[model samples]
Target: MKNSKVFLSLCAVLFILPSLDAQTKRIKRPKSRVGVGSVDRFVQESFDLYDKVYKYDGYAAAGTPLDDDDIDVLEEALEEMTVLSESAPDIIDDLDGVGVLKQGKATLQMNKAKKALKYSIKTAKELLLGQREREAQENEDDTAETESGDSPDISGTSGNQKDGADVEAEEEPSNISDKLEVYSKFDFVPGDKLLYFDDFSQDFIGDFPSKWNTNGTGEVVTVGSVEGKWFELKGGYGIQFLPLLSEALPEEYTIEFDLLAVVDTKTSSTARLNLTLADNNEFRDGPNKSSVELPLGQFGAFSIRVFNRINGGTVINSSLNANLRQAVLNKPHISVAVNKRRFRLWVNQKKYVDIPQFIAPDKALSHIKFNLLGMRDGVDRLFITNLKVAEGGVDLRRKLMAEGRISTNGILFDSGSANIQPRSLGIVRQISQVLMQDQSIKLNIIGHTDSDGPDEANLALSKARANAVKEALVTIYKISEERLTTEGKGESEPVGDNTTADGKAQNRRVEFVKI
Candidate 1:
């Protein structure tokens, strides 16, 4: 009788399995590739228009948008990006090739679609996990509830339960929820993208990641050749992970690279990797501070410092393993990760550091505090052959950094300073990059001077400096000065101090105050 009962249950499950399988056929999966004769033609036409739109050198073409139907023509083209952003990643390893700047609206639309896809994937994952947990709990509760009742003998009640076996079997597969999850197999946004950061590149973000600003303006970052590095110096951003990070990110993530310094410098003008997580605008409020320094080589080191509004400051209380202690000062394969709040640093694939947990940085859900920024100087060049950002890796600092949003403040030079050095020019271009990310922004350019510089001289100088930068924007950049303004604040306001040379330098600055 026992054997017969077992056989019946097995047969019941087998009979019901096929029906369960059919329910999962809800939405058709995206084809690995989508193309046809007419579809192919449409794609090509859209791409062709894309090329034309991106070439907008700060001005429109003669009688453009067909002289009348700007909205219709552009809207049609923008829609194509929905298909393109999804498929482009498959064809090209680097999403950068999509060239979102091909058109303003199109770029915004593409980002929206991609971001939506990511959220869907996340949701689906959560749903799927919740279902599994529910199923497990149901089973546990059923057993417990059953055990609590009077013990059933091998009699009529047990036979009744067996008769309804098929009903119970039917509920098993409903647990495979149709909802997408965070780790969606098809849609999770690839965290890595190789993007250009030089002045020549176009701004692509429609709704930029938070903490990304070009304010505190000094020099516009642009593409320039560096001796050691292959293509250029400050030419491209190594990895722009997020606009901001609000909390301790994934338990594991890493930013690893094999870099070679172009030249050596003693004044600690070393290339840096910034990990910032804060929303207070004040650097100290968050855990990721510039003060937390990571060392690299003796010639130079890969240092971890608290990086935010105030910039890099050595962490005094850090108890990082001495090996992973210093920043990659000169050049080496360095990896940074944050796991369980503890930061781990690695050099050349070797364990370098294990430091204390940092303060959680997310004050708001939408705001981001995590960031990873690389530094390069004109005097000394650094070649980064492979700079990869992998979320959830052995390196704790790198992990948190992947989610961290980068700030544009450090790109420029000291406050009250207006030299626009070659190094910081890339920064200026970077800021322009942030502005260009959202075309709707109107900017006011204000230049300040140290108190000692003679107010009149400083004011005149400030005005000239603003105009000089304006020329770069109007002429070199071709951005419409329609929304741009230049003002001079000649030492009337001091951000820092003017008594010391450093303070004086800090006081003289040109700002891109948001309008």
Candidate 2:
């Protein structure tokens, strides 16, 4: 009895542990290179089972009573599954590390699965053809009897009825390969780089501006036969992004393009240099519509307005700095360049925006978008083509962490106070959302700052801010303290240059790191 009880206890632990671990495991999702994949397995199996009944005599002879309508539905599902399976790998791989591979031994099996589904659909069509023939023959027989004004006395097979059924069954080929082919091709992958609306599809109903909703003169314009317009970027209008593309854009990368524009104005509007990277809190979430416009000047490398200052986040309207950028407006060539944060814009082969030891482009903006605000007033027209991308350089998140720049979880304070700000409410709200999704994971909110003030002052202030953030989340957000912790780092850590305005802004910020 003792041994039996021990065995039972062992079994109970084994049964409960795996489920408990799964609940606690943090999910890190890698980006999928390809979109669609093979169809769901159960769905494919259902198709195959029903399809065989329609094609081969073997299934018919087994005495199953499934109808033709059911057969039709199954065959259609099979076709769709084949397409999906071809695009998405995980749907069929059912294995760890399978989704990331380009091609492998497992991929071969997936190919077979796809082929089998295709054949299954083909078979079902053939069976449907046979059923239609049977119906036709019965009609023919009844018509003959009615016309003769007599009923047959004997029940016997007729040559005419058999001939009719054969003709009807011959109508559709169960072998899809010999009957028809399905294919998908694209001339252009249309849509904006930063923000995409629901209408980023071929359907007419989804192509509405209200859904994408841009502020200012930025209309959704269509230039020539280039087709549908999702975002029509107007000159001097800056667009703020909602935290898309992971956190920030990648650094040490080549951002090549496929853009279309018209530079018809001599106001240097034609030579608009588009700006893609901007870092500020005003553009983080709802900054009441901000913009950082790029003025692509005519014939000069990306340095004509090298020394200009108009500091409003991003906007449609430009102040004195708008004219300072010197847009030549009517240039007709799409440009490409490699940019470093400090290096700025390099146009037509020259180191422009030549600030020293600059910050690289924001890693949060790892997207395929262009900046077109600067030069193109009326004469500027650009047609974008051939999008190409490659990345290198230090990983932003890792670098920031190495230098104690950004923490995964951090406290936010109200501006200008060591005491926790009321606005840390936003950060608390987001943390609450994360906790709501994950029940087992724990969080730590550590605070840090730039070295503008004394070390003791900064450290104490950081602690106050951190504690305030903790209290608000626990008391107001109602998060359990068992899963929370807070700490403070004074002026000892710095993520950006303490000398520049942008760097100081980054330095004097909260950092959150997962423990």
Candidate 3:
């Protein structure tokens, strides 16, 4: 009777498996607001479920009997697999109208989840059968021992050896050093001097940042699963947010910030975030201005539009589809460099725009403005942080050759971490060029830290960061490791005030000295 029951249960599960596949094929694609975040969350959840099931399968395959709790968990996982498999098709279809970048990611995630679910079902069934067989064998042994007048063996061993069951090994997490290799061709060198820097750390939550002014409402808020404070900008037709600069932007400067957009299918097709350098700091656009506009919606190609005006007359206006829809969904670093009339922009490591005449030569761009267009008031939003504007055009090689040393705050890292920011490679790249040009030049790379943490921890972090820079030069730029030495000064050397934001920004620097 027990065998019959187990057989019936297995038969029922096998029957449902085919039906589930058929249902997925027949179901119509529903209009959903499923964003990249939603798809990522579902994939993570499915993987978690798969992990639980796989562990139980491993134990069962190792000739271990399943405990009551293990069986219950496996039963729950089976139900979860059913639900996840049913939902995957719809979640994948959400990427239909999005750019290939987003589609490719979603498709890969969904396929992985599908395979995990399939293997989970197979393991679950085999586990059930093995448990039933073990129980039956134990009962038969008990009857034989009773008839032979001998005691039953109490050893915790099972003869059932699962054949050909291979568990997949977990992949190792990737390191930042390995990730830096992709930025070998990255040529974005940030400005040498820091003019304006804000990470919103000093601001109170729900309050607008002190250093910025906006025609529309915005407040600093922390996002779920994302680090640091983000200034969330509310969208409207002509909303403009400006950072209050003490002086007009110089002829050579660079601007950088981290951008994240919370969007869905309902996000307007026309919604975009515009970065503008205008003549005036007012809420309106000035006569002389240059703007880079990026679409913030999920349903369109990742495209950028640039507009230039000189003396209240439009001079240059154009747009390009960058095929970066998926990248925009993830938090991306935005870098912009202006050397007199030359304008360049990079999203992370990839340079998207470089124009010789994008900015008018005679016009002075004094103010930086952020504008949001066609986004819903509450449903769609944009968040930005770590805004850094610096004066560029410094000849690092000449300065190093003349002064025998060069120090720069441009080589940034994650908060208290040695992991080099990919954008920071521009400065390091310049150092590598210098090294390549002069093979006999040996140098000492020293790392510094702001006085924010324990002295010992800061010292360790500084050392790790210097070593990371050395690794980048050797691995990415193919510089000789023998010529490069590293040191860490921690917070002992004070070039700037630790008490102020600008001072801290100045203090957290990397120095290359001739040896």
Candidate 4:
């Protein structure tokens, strides 16, 4: 009796401890030192279980009962997912460490784990109860001396069908079109000229990028699991980052970059991304604080602060709270258009701030610097990628005569085919408008390709692409085909190196020269 009681006590402890721990235990996430590897590992492990175990066939032949191993794996996956779900919210604050993309992915995976666990638990319980009920019914039928019927019992099957029907009845089709229609409000478009672009592909992983300079430490790391390469800012102590260039920034240029913020832990302290324009061609060190008066002859600045939690903080200065929310919650795509002294900033397709009087008297911005505000050590990281600085509001006449040709990346074609994407319509329309306004002008539409495949294939593709553009101009934009001629360069003249993606993007272009 004593031994049996002891065994029972042991079983109770084994069962109760897990539940207790789960209810009370808090995850100890690294404060200033979480790597992409940690996040990737957790996410990959969670997805592996989701794909291999949760998606695996757990049902038997008749009763559709799950084995002990299947139940255990499902339960394990759910438990692991629960930990991930709890921890993700904490780490997601640092845009560079764990951006909107990974956080969104974690949320989805957690939901899957929940659904799979619920189904498994419910199925197991039902199977056990069903077996007992069948046994009782069979005994009653035997006692009554009933003969076996030609047909099997349909009541059990009908009950399952009814349950399924109830579930189906509860669910409604998603209004996907309605959701998509909401995006009709999005009107953000890229600038016309591509002056300078960097995707961080030219930089080797784990090294500081060659094109950028910073006061504090940072490294170029690839989040290979999620598909991006970024320059991750090391937490603690504010840093100023400047992209190195020989030519001064254009007065009416646009700047764009992708940002991911990661919060080391939940904190009232906000994360800040400050972009300051400097008149001098020299590098300045330390925090790029806009509130503080700069040294003599320096340009102005714009700062954006993203709060950790919703309603956690207020927007200071001219920064938009909506943009702050976007920066904190999603991998924000930042767009800045500087039309001389006037400036406009858009975060994740929404216009955030527009300053008509951005530049001060007697000071024009020659360069720009990125500054990250410091939080707790090991708690915050800011990541930046796809930095593009382009001249906005094109001068068509200047581009044609001064440059001897009008080149554009605006005209695009479908992948692996000569078909045009709908988004290319805007550029095509602009070109058509230019042509229509100047009836005396004739154009030789030439196509160019990156050095990727065979020369012959590239030549064919480029020629086909050029022809397709001409056809689009004639059919859609109603341009005269007789006014246009076509040719292909086939990577013979590349503006950029073929080794990198950014370089390849530059190499693949379409030009219309005076005929």
Q: Model 1, 206-250: lDDT tens per residue?
A: 322122332221121222452222212231243323332233334
lDDT for model 2: 0.38
Model 3 stretches astray by more than 4 angstroms? 1-177, 393-395
Per-model TM against the reference: 0.25, 0.25, 0.68, 0.50
- Which has the higher TM-score value, candidate number 1 or candidate number 4? 4
Comparing 3 with 4 on lDDT, the higher-scoring candidate is 3
Candidate lDDT (C-alpha), each = 0.36, 0.38, 0.74, 0.53
In model 3, state the lDDT of residue 53: 60
**RMSD in angstroms, candidate 1?**
26.5
Candidate 1 lDDT for residue 365: 13
Better of 1 and 2 by lDDT: 2
- The collision pairs in model 3 are none
Using lDDT as the yardstick, the better of models 1 and 3 is: 3
lDDT of 4: 0.53
lDDT minimum window of 10 residues, candidate 2: 179-188
**Against the true structure, candidate 1 has what lDDT?**
0.36
Instruction: Find the 10 residues in a row with the least total lDDT in model 3.
Output: 21-30
